[model samples]
Target chain A: MFPEELKYSKEHEWVKLEGNVATIGISSYAQEELGDVVFVELPKAGQEYKANDEIGVVESVKTVSTLYCPVSGKVTAINDELSTQSALINQDPYGKGWIAKVEMSNPAEVESLLSAKDYQSQLAG
Target chain B: MLKKTALYKNHIDLKAKMVPFAGWEMPVFYPAGIIAEHKAVRSSCGVFDVGHMGLINIKPQTSNIKKAEEFLNKIGTNDVSKLIDFSCQYSVLCNEQGGVVDDVLIYKLIDHYIVVVNASNTDKVLAWLSSHAQDIEIEHLLDMSILAVQGPRSLDVIEELFGEEFGFNVLKRNNFLQVGNILVSRTGYTGEDGFELFIPLEEIEIIWDKVVEMKVQPCGLGARDTLRMEAAYPLYGHEYDEKTTPLDAGYSWAVKFGKGEFIGSKALSKEKEAGPKKRLVGVVLSEKNVPREGFKLFNGGAEPIGEITSGTFSPTLEKPIGLAYINNSCHEKNISVEVRGRRVAGEIVTLPFYKHS
Candidate 1:
């Protein structure tokens, strides 16, 4: 289930904002949609920002998908711990599985995201 | 995009993740992950909608069964004479040059025989079978549905679902036992002990729902792949096709020339005497990089030798493994895979990368 507090993207990524920083991770729905994520190539720290740009790779047993940015920002942190323990995304897509932390370049860019209800309805359609 | 099966709506109703396979919208998995579904078959029963495969029924003149023997050799199943009606076998239908046309199932169902072939090779096998057997009578050529209920617990599941009267031990290979309307055969693609049921296309949903109610997981192509690979079974298109020979695919046992004549036999005999130039071998990537399809294979000395045909991150082995066609000499020696240009040391193993538990 998606939390109404978070902003979403059509690509199934969720961004939770606190001030100008966004803790970004794939939505629980995304992780569930892509069964058994074997590996995730998260964006590197210090990488520059963009909205709807390919930032990382999320690989399941069957396919490799590109994770896109929903809001423009510069990468400040990534869950380096996921490199060796990739299954963390399946276990905790919301908290410990957060892919990267970005410092937003323009706070107004958050408006580009769809709300939780809209994302769920998008999947239903 | 509108291709649907009898159970298509039911699959969507059960929240099945559908994918396009051979132009058919088929379920690849349900809520459970691939690994979980795979393990279920290893320890319990699981059902698969292999309804996509082609089924052709042929009624050759009883006397022409001898001529059918000739087609066997023509097809690279050297052992045509040894095949009996109650006997089911795996064979590769070949073109004129001894290259595989399709890996097929030769089942003698009743007086007329039946063949179950790959969905992708349906038309090819049909045309090949038609062109060769001009004298033979092909009775009803229908698109029948087939399902595989496989795993160690499959027998029990079958008993529970269809009653013990179906004859657990009596139903031999190539022989079909009718339970109500279902024809249950002791056959499956997964190396696990199970049966492949041939039912009317329309009744697929009814039987599928019953099996699901009996706790048989509706596994998709994803689990089907991992399960078959673990069993060391060959994928028709990937491991062998119009370009690869069965002898090179470790299927020399299926070819029996002792009885009589067949197509591709002469060329296969030549290749057998001379030995296939490239052989299919199993290899496990010893490093982190996944050995994907088309990855070049090299000798331990870093010299290019061959390339991977089918590869995947094995759910059972918890590592990358694959099947590759390599030089016979290099196959005997150890080899490595070049994943994105880096040579990862891999030992040349046998057919299966993982044994069934």
Candidate 2:
């Protein structure tokens, strides 16, 4: 189940916007499909990125997947705890496993992301 | 289209994540996850649907033991004579150029020998045997299915199911016994002690359901890979391929250099004298970064040495482990692996990253 407050991407990432800074992490569905999260690579703070840019990577024991930015922004902060406790993504992807915080370069970019209902439909199909 | 085994429906009923592997649609893991299944195999009993492995029975010609011994020795790298009755031996089928065709397990029965090969290389191995072996009756038992029940508690589960029919106490490692129509062997791919039961396809579901009823964890290929990697067992495609030999995979002991005429014996002997191009070694990462297959390896400095063949996070050891074939010159401790363009410090350690005491 996707949270109503969050916007989702087709790549299974979720974003939470508070004013111009948007918090991002992979959805619970993504983590569940990934089985166990063994490692996470997040973009460094102050790094600028465009929408759909490959910002980081997440690795399970069997697979490696690239993480894409859903909105154009500069990385204001990243979850440092993921380096030691990547399982947090599998345990609680929405809360403690939040990957990064970006200072949105274009506030209008949030409208391009899927709503919770749209994300649920996408997963259903 | 991918082929499905007899247990495919059962895996789907349990909500397993299915993936295509070696032409078969097999379960990669279940909801309990890979680490949980791996721990089950290491700590207790776990049943794997290895139905894809090929079972080839080489019946004796004129019931002559010498002929069977001679035929097997020609194809196998390990000495077939060392195998006692009801025992199993690991060997590889090599080409004339000393490259491995496929790794196999030869089981010596009372009247015939059975060779178990990788599912993907079954046809290739059969063709190789057919061309080299003369007058030996080679029967590909495709109707049979294999179930690898592994761990310390494997016999306990087997005893619960077939206690009255068979005795588990006498089945030593690398040995097998017949119970009714099934062949139960004390051999497994995992380093853990277990039994590999080769049973008829029609009756396999009965044993599979019974084992599941006893709460033996039903593992998939995902856990199988991690467990074997932790045990330091070389996978066919990962460690050795058509161009890689046993010696290149750090299995020189399996190749008897001075043995009688056999396939690749001459080339292997020459390579032994001249030295191999690369050597396989176990690498343990000091950082938490998980090194994956094809990730580049470097020596203590920036000089690129080789690449990783198989890698995973060892659940038992609680560290990242990998297997790589580094250049012979960089055969030292304290190497580095480049994952995503960043070098992570790694130390070359001995094989069998996890061993049961």
Candidate 3:
């Protein structure tokens, strides 16, 4: 169930660009693969991260997975609700489960991300 | 190639997430997820398709029951002579080095004894039993299927399925009874009043469908592991391996030394007198980070004390809990586990993180 407006990465992350700030969260497929999310460790705001850097950690009942930064930028905000309710990622991966918002440092990185159709094909392949 | 259980098609119909485990393509969880399946068993009722476990029968060549008992007693850590008809006992097979070969449940039937071994160690245990056979016949029941119905409401589910006249409600724990073609045992891995039904391969699907029709949640191995962990049950390859003795695994009560000479008895007796070098202990982490298997343990020092054997987030306790084999020398009050290369503070707690009262 890939949203049409979202850009996706091979690592199963979805990004939504609204001007200079890009909202990022794991895809619905990633949440399904992780099972029930029990805990999440989000990065602090104002911290800068390069593309493909480890941005956060997601822990489910079975295992843990590392979330990667899709675009190099400073973290503007993170969803603080995940500290108490990590299952939001499973319930709403596109909306309320957004992990972080990054103020982009390199806008050209968006072109490298796959569209919703391409990302769905990548998952099938 | 992975082996499929009798309920493989049923699991697929339920939309279960299948994963490879112990050479079988088993369902790890259903669409309800592991946490929900776990909670359902805790509060209501849940069914598990554990047909992957091995069932080996030890029958005497003659009508002499004593010879069969003696043979089993020599190979197992527990006393087999104490088992009465329709009763089962938890025991462990050990190597000569005092390490565990596999933990099993020995069910003594009228004419023969059935030993249920772990799925992964089925072939090894069969060969081990065959090598030690004297006048005993060790037959593997490859076409058997095991269904475990567990929870607080498990008795009700059993009554609903088999009817009240069967008297399953009165069946004592660790005891089994033979129905027409099925053998029902009042035993389970989950810390709950439950029953394990030993059904024929062809009959398992019908029983499973009936159980599901009654609104019983069908659980997978993912929930099974968490349920057993919460109950502090020692699993093979995790707490008890070829190198881990029953003494080190906190299963001393099951090892009866007064039963006379058995496999690994001399070595285990020596270890008992001197005490185990390392002991399995439960640790509760202060943080939410899970301490996985092979993670190093520290006692507030630079040196590592031991390593985790099994770790998971306890859905009931809502905390990260684990079992570790810490060196007995390290008696520090505060311990830490290295999780993802970071130290997380923890404290040693009593076993069975969650007990059903």
State how far residue B199 of model 1 sits from its true place (Å): 1.3
B101-156, model 3: which lDDT tens digit per residue? 99999999988999999999999999999999999999999888899999999999
- Candidate 1, TM-score vs. the true structure? 0.87
Model 2, C-alpha of A37: deviation from truth (Å): 0.8
DockQ of each: 0.51, 0.75, 0.85
lDDT of 1 by residue, B1-357 (tens): 546666788889888899888778988888887878887888788899887888877665666566555554455474645566655677778776778888888776446567788887887777787777766765434546888899877888778877887577667655567677677888887778888988888788888898889888878888898788777788887888887888888888877767555677777778999988988878886664556678888765556788887776677778767778888766354677876456778888877776655
With candidate 3 superimposed using the best TM-score fit, by how many Å does residue B160's alpha carbon deviate from the native?
A: 1.1
Interface RMSD per candidate (angstroms):
1.6, 0.9, 0.7
Against the true structure, whose TM-score is highest? 3
Candidate 2 lDDT at B33 equals 87
Candidate with the larger lDDT of 2 and 3: 3
